[model samples]
Target: MSGDPLERIAAALERLAPGPAAAPDWDAASAFVWDAHPDALHPVPEVSRVPLGLLVGIDRQRDTLLANTRRFAEGLPANNALLWGARGMGKSSLVKAVHAELEATGLKLVELQREDIGTVGRLLALLRGAPHRFVLYCDDLSFSHDDAAYKSLKAVLDGGATGRPANVVFYATSNRRHLMPRDMIENERGSAINPAEAVEEKVSLSDRFGLWLGFHACDQDGYLAMIRGYCAAHGLDVDDAALRAEAIEWQATRGARSGRVAWQFFTDLAGRHGVRI
Candidate 1:
């Protein structure tokens, strides 16, 4: 209805800009997924995660992360954690499992997808003054050469001027320790006038995390232990010798041995045994 050109332009811009994100019902669920487009938090009634005991071969990581999360939940000093290592080694699973284990401590789990990294500051703003503590988790996170989203992540990790909310902590899982491909880092070094500074700027994003837990590839024994643990947890009966022989063959065919592989193998074995997990 505005006749003036300036007023009309302003109205159009206002319509284009995204509205403020809605305040989430913190008590709605133990876990939530962040959606950037609509700027909302979708509650997850049932999060898919195995028990802490079922996770094998990464005891150090499990213990350390669990302690860190517990401390955060207790209102103690804690650091943002980065779980970086081999794929299918349970980086993201550990984050979820730790939160589940400590759910009674009044901690909340907020999952933010890698593509939603740019909107993290807005997400943090919504949680900044909330009463409950939050573990903002990003799974399978990494940055491409052209990606600038990592800068936004720094605001969450480093917490610019106002500083990160005491009630909120960040947890991210990535295969790369630096959250960048090796070739990308090398390219920065080769192209930039000051290679050190260039590389530092790119790699320093990972340094923001106070805790770095590395997950190595699982060995045959560890793999088998994971399978046995799953079987025991699910009450799936199997002979040790037969399980070992079949599991080894399964891994050999798949060409990798990790918690995920073990679980996949178990799923098939459970199905064959007519057992439900």
Candidate 2:
């Protein structure tokens, strides 16, 4: 034990400060969830994601993201992608599905929560030198009016000094196209002396993403197709007429029709029919 007061104080400070995070075992799993408190990547042995073929609507988004992810995995040029638009349109699902399809290419998926946006630089530093390529995913990403975490996100997307590691590509899903609420942008425009620049400062964060894919609300036909696809995949036998009537009634009850709503309906139908999905 140190007898000197200065040495004792230094020891206490060192103990309080978190130690450098340990390097993760790259071969542990295909997907991981970043835990910011302890600064660790927890392996996800089984990622809950639907098959690429089963995603009925949004074929255009499916193809584009697949191609982009493929390029990144192959060590070719690729862009950080932002999947933004309507709720329950499978923005986050697509990210996972694409990564699953390309997992054989030595590509990995690391989920970064929206709350941990500030620790992205530290996360990046850990992944910078890893051998496997990573798709850094953040689901339902959005920023509030007073939040400054967006600046940290900019650093990841813009890659300030040490450019984003060659092995890492960022992919985020959000309901907001600009990653901020419309009211927040309008607030900035109303208050700032230079309205354009003020709005631009916040909106420009989205411009950092090279690929901006938008997912809109699925049409009735598209919604029905999603249900049919799920039924077929699980081999749940139901008459088309009955299925249509029941599914329509279900949608009516929910007051919305989306891939998610369709799945919810199918889940109930499957349970009734004793079919496991």
Candidate 3:
């Protein structure tokens, strides 16, 4: 009262802040991020993901992802997903896209990084009590020789005291089918007394994923089709022959064909034609 009304209110609020707080409860979060530095769950609201419709040239994979995602959102049993294979072929994109599609049905996608794989149990605990369905997504997930976080992942997937949340599903992408290097597996194969036992280390990790959706490099026809799809969707004015030639040239310069390459081609064509898309 002596100084200002605002100052008195601010001082009272400051006194209420918690000090030396205990670990945050997983049950309180609708979303959680694995902060590996402190090994904690950080809540987030907005997740970055593209629309499912923008994804092109992978019809089969798209349908599969959509079907699985819908099933999970509907409170039905769904598999833990593993999106593996070629890089930049829309594996990670599809996960985000599907998450967005399912949002209309009240499901959410929570993304975590590859390095934070060790904290999956903590994440699982948070999701365990969530009323909302969650899709835990990890992009570019893999393990090296010294990183043994796969064991924690395995336990959370099916072996932990608090099993995977009934309302949660996991989606991870990796270039390797077996989340470890071939040399690492081979070296273990050579050193171990039992080769079968040694290889199981890698196999068991992959085996945890109930669904395996593979992405591969696009062929010429497939690549062109993707370009045409983008052009049509964006309502860009370009004849098939002219568009085909330009897209081919773009891919040739890059020396490889993937979904990422196709999008880049579309971007350049859009600019050349003065299309705002």
TM-score of 3: 0.83
Q: lDDT by residue for model 3 over 208-252, one digit each (tens)?
A: 888888888989998887778788888987888888888888999
Top-scoring candidate (TM-score) = 1
- The numbered model that scores best in lDDT is 1
Q: Go through the candidates in order and give each one's C-alpha lDDT.
A: 0.92, 0.91, 0.80
Better of 1 and 2 by lDDT: 1
Clash count for each candidate, listed in order shown: 0, 0, 0
Q: For residues 1-277, write the lDDT of model 1, one tens digit per residue.
A: 6399998999899999998888888888999999998899999999999899999999999999999999999999999999999999999899999999999877999999999999988898998878899999999999998999888888888757877888889999989899988999998899999999988977888888999999999989999999999999999889999999999999999999899999999999999999998
Once fitted onto the true fold, the runs of candidate 3 whose alpha carbons sit more than 4 angstroms away are 1-34, 37-48
RMSD values for the candidates in order, in angstroms, are 1.2, 1.6, 8.0
Sort by lDDT, top down from the best = 1, 2, 3
Count of backbone collisions in candidate 2: 0
Q: What is the TM-score of each candidate against the true structure?
A: 0.97, 0.96, 0.83
Estimate candidate 3's alpha-carbon lDDT, on a 0 to 1 scale: 0.80
Candidate 2 lDDT over residue span 1-277, tens digit each: 5399998999899999877678788898999999999898999999999999988889999999999999999999999999998888899889999999999888999999999999999899889878789999999999998999998897778647877888889999999888988999998899999999988877999999999999999988999899999988998879999999999999999999888898899999999999988
